[model samples]
Target: MYLISGAECFDPSPRGQVDVLVAGGQVIAIVEPGTLNVDAEQIDARGKILVPGLVDALTHPCGGGGEGGFGNRTAEIDVETFVRAGVSAPVGALGTDSIGRSLDVLYGNVMGMRTQGLNAFMLSGAYRVPAPSLTGDIARDIYLVAPVVGVGEVAIADHRGTQPTAQELRRLAAETQLGGILGGEGGTVLVHVGAGDSRLALLREAIEGSDLAPSVLYPTHVNRSTALLDEAADWALRGGFVDITVSTTKELIAAGDITAEQALRRLLEAGAPAEKITMSSDAGGSLPVYVDGELVGLTAASPGSLSDLLRALFADHADLFPLALAAMTRNPASALRLNAAGEIREGTRADLLLLDPAHGVDSLMCGGNWLLRHGEYLN
Candidate 1:
């Protein structure tokens, strides 16, 4: 058992000076400050912040893709980078390339993260229609597969996508949403936003015309283009969550369209609900700068950007309560169906991060185990 005190906790909401107790891999209790008097070792939060560990709701955790043969595929990441970034939980997703993306590979990736002490799960498909499936049907896989949540990153509006018709998209969404209900999880249909002229027309049609609740559509990479980002904001206004990728936001800032700081501010200013926006580092994924279909430049996502986004949010005077932690924690928890995850509350998993609020990650804990202490790995 452990007692973590002296810091405010963010379940994406402010809980002042909470003494969080952990045991048996779950957060057993949250006591009044100084409630526990055991000689049990105490780790101070240092008046910093204690938030439910950040969640990367969407990522290609097993090294995203290889548009250029096996050599082009990025290598899989280990536990160190994730913990360092304050990502105690991650929801893996498959990107555009699907040849090497197999259901078996996806399952192994989720289990591998669990082995290394992370809450891991995955969406079942890439950006294709007749979308890739482990059980031959989206709904079946969602109900039958353990880690499967919903179908995703189904590429729309991009040349790379299967360019699913509105009808096809509707069918997929209906199946996914139903499956999520049956499985008692959120049936989030993932979409990968690309910089195409059509923008989010297909998505809009799906929402406007279909019976599915708008919240079920989880679109990501909104910052890839200014127009796309705006479309994402509109989606949020219409009650859908948007995934603003860290690197894509960086590119936007570089182009003067908006800073990562501004992109967030815009989301809030638009009166979009706070919980409707989430962020992720497409870590272990490729960032290709394509010109005329020739890959001119490419960069793999760095784990540091997630921290950079959070730090930037704090630096920009953004509210720390919901803004700082939810994008990383509760929002993902709600979007993906990971109960007993997200938040620093009773009966939740003990995936936690302790920060200086001024500096950054000082210690990390997962499943009641101190994986990181004083900025160093315990084991």
Candidate 2:
């Protein structure tokens, strides 16, 4: 048993000055400060801020978007990177470059990370539909593979996309929806909405005309274009999740385009439900700026951007818990249906983080294992 005390807890209950008690990789209890009935190691977190570890639902932690393997493909995140960033959970997906990407690879990767005591899950396939998968079929993979929780990175409007027809979109959504049903998960045909004027009409039509729930079809990178974002906002109002990519301060500032912070503001101002909004780092994925069908500049995505977005939002005077943290934690968990995560509470897995008052991660615990303490990793 362990007692983590002297911190404000962001458990959705949002209790201040409480102590968390963890036993065997789960939050055994949460109580008023100084209240506990067990002998345990102690972590004095006085004056520190405590928050549920963040969740990245749409990261390409499988290694993505770049050519070359081993040396060139980005390595999957270690426990330390996640802990240091206050991310206790990562929901991975593959991106545009799909060679060497497979369901088996994603499955094995998620298992390896979970074994090291982080809550890791993955969405199978990549930017093309008829998406890449394992077990030979999407539904079978979801049922047989523990980590194959969903399918996506299905590119839509980008030049890199398959430019699938509406019939193709409906077919894919139906297939994915069936996979989720048989697998007891939110089998989302997670779409990669793009910057074209076509926007998400195909998705809207499928949801309206079919039996699939609107919540099951997630659209990421909505902030990639201004007009496309307007479509995303409308989709959110109709009950779908929109994922904005995180940015470095420089990238966010220079973007002059929509940012996660600005998107959140605009999303809320447009009456998009706060909980319906999420943000992903798009880490290890590529951010390419194109002109006249030419690549002008390309920057590799980094896991570091997750924390960077939070810190930048702090400067904007936004509320951290309900707004920023939800995008990182609860929203993703809800979208992925990762049980007992995205919030800190009794009986939940102890996937929690301690942050400085300014919200920088200071320590992290995933599944009750302290991978990082005072900024150091046990692993």
Q: Which candidate should be chosen as best, given TM-score against the real structure? A: 1
Tell me, by lDDT, which candidate is best.
Answer: 1
- Separately for all candidates shown, the number of backbone clashes (residues 3 or more apart, or on different chains) is 2, 0
- Residue 330 Cα positional deviation in candidate 1, in Å, after optimal superposition: 1.0
Q: Residues 1-379, candidate 2: write the lDDT tens digits.
A: 7899998776743577899899998888889988686799988899787778788877776666564334456656565666677777787787777666766666777788788877888887778867778766777766667777788878887777877776777777677667777877757767887666777887887677677677878898888667777788899898888888874335434554577777778878888888888888877675655566565555557666776676665556547545877788888788766676789878888888887756577888888888888877887
Question: Compared to the true structure, candidate 2 yields what TM-score?
Answer: 0.90
What's the alpha carbon RMSD for model 2? 3.1
Q: What lDDT does model 2 reach?
A: 0.75
Off by over 4 Å in 1: 68-70, 249-257, 288-297, 316-321
lDDT of 2 at 274: 82
Candidate 1 versus the native: TM-score? Answer: 0.91
Tell me the deviation in Å of residue 252 in model 2.
7.8
